[model samples]
Target chain A: MKFLEPGLIALDVEAADGAAAIRAAGQLLVDAGAAESRYIDAMVASFEEKGPYFVLAPQIALPHAKPEDGVKEASVSLVRLREPVVFGHAKNDPVALVFALGASSSEEHITMLRKLTTLLNNPAHVQQLKDAPTPEAIGQLLEATTN
Target chain B: MKIICVCGLGQGTSLILRMNVENVLKDLGVSADVDHMDVSSASGTQADYIITNNELAQSLQGHAAKIVIVNNYFDLEEIKSSLQEVL
Candidate 1:
């Protein structure tokens, strides 16, 4: 199933820092009715609590929080920053893409993550996502890559 | 064999790690049950190894399972090399 939608993507957004970047992505989930507003705070706080472990790859940050932390639905959102920001991760920093994910349970999370991991493993695809000019472009890219 | 992928929240990052660890183990022809959980829950869980990042590995220092610190959750080569040494 196609879970990620064009409306879920926010391209070339401006953020002062990593927290704001996360907020930009997380806010999209909230706006999509996938999560409560506080879910965004939980995602931001998770970075502070655990450092940049969520910065899974160079130029990529998958900011997320627990299902119990206000996730109303299982969903993912994308936000590409106009300017990359450092997440303080030793290796992966200056993150350019923020994917804010919210899951109501592990089973639901596993389904979404399988697609996410596959799409992210290819650097070309990552670059495509980064260079995608519009939300529809990003959505089309993800749809084309799904297993 | 059993492995638990852990993180502070035990939801996003750890789940990603768990999937990679499962993949690495499969590549090595090793049969193992992989799980993911929060740090607090990890302390009470039974596992042969607890795969976690460098920072979360600190609080998990005294857990029964051996701690394997992975710096990058997305790097399959890094995950495989680290798991090979201990597994």
Candidate 2:
């Protein structure tokens, strides 16, 4: 089962800032038909209002908005940036990995979070994602997490 | 004790943190009603502890519940230690 569409996976992306990085990630969801374009704006606004709390770990970010924001379907997307962007997070700054989630309900969100946390808790798996040579390699890493 | 995990979106990162917090609390034999909430709505809710990162912790500084700032949400040890300090 492929939760992350092949088109949604990108490697070595260039982003100017954290919001730009999030936008790039969110765009993947848009292309996959999982989220509306306005969802990107909601994600950006949420980040601006609540600060960089989405920076889950060092070099990683999980950017998302409320289910009511603009979710068309439940999905997750990943973006690996060529250059890390400063998100103003104290410990987790200069994030190079962005994970954007679009869920239609809180249940879906929680379920996805459960799987994501399992993957994130392992430092080695996260390192693999950071050092993934290609988008396909990144997809394989994420697929392992889903299972 | 009711603990609320506050984040930008109620269901994303905060929910993940909530799960880790639940696990750590279980290991320590600490029982509490842990909830996940969004930053804006979290202000009005009641909780014994409001667990969040430094960014959102600022918004919840004066809340009645004790605010625990977690620098690394994925670091279970760090989370366990932080909870040990206040719990």
Predicted complexes: DockQ each: 0.56, 0.81
lDDT of 2 at B52: 92
| lDDT score at residue A37, model 2, on the 0-100 scale | 96
Candidate 1 lDDT score at position A18: 91
lDDT of 2 by residue, A1-147 (tens): 124566878989999999999999999998888888999999999888778888988898989887788898777888999999999989899899898988667566666777778888889888998888887886788787767
What docking class should model 2 receive? high
TM-score of chain A of each: 0.94, 0.91
How far out, in Å, is residue A83 in model 2?
0.9
Winning candidate number (TM-score): 2
TM-scores vs. true structure, each candidate: 0.91, 0.93
Model 2 CA deviation exceeding 4 Å by range: none
TM-score of candidate 1 versus the correct structure, residues matched by position: 0.91
lDDT of 2 by residue, B1-87 (tens): 899999876777888899999999999998899999887799999888999998778777778999998888889999999999998
Clashes of 1: 0
The candidate maximizing lDDT is 2
Candidate 1 lDDT score at position B21: 88
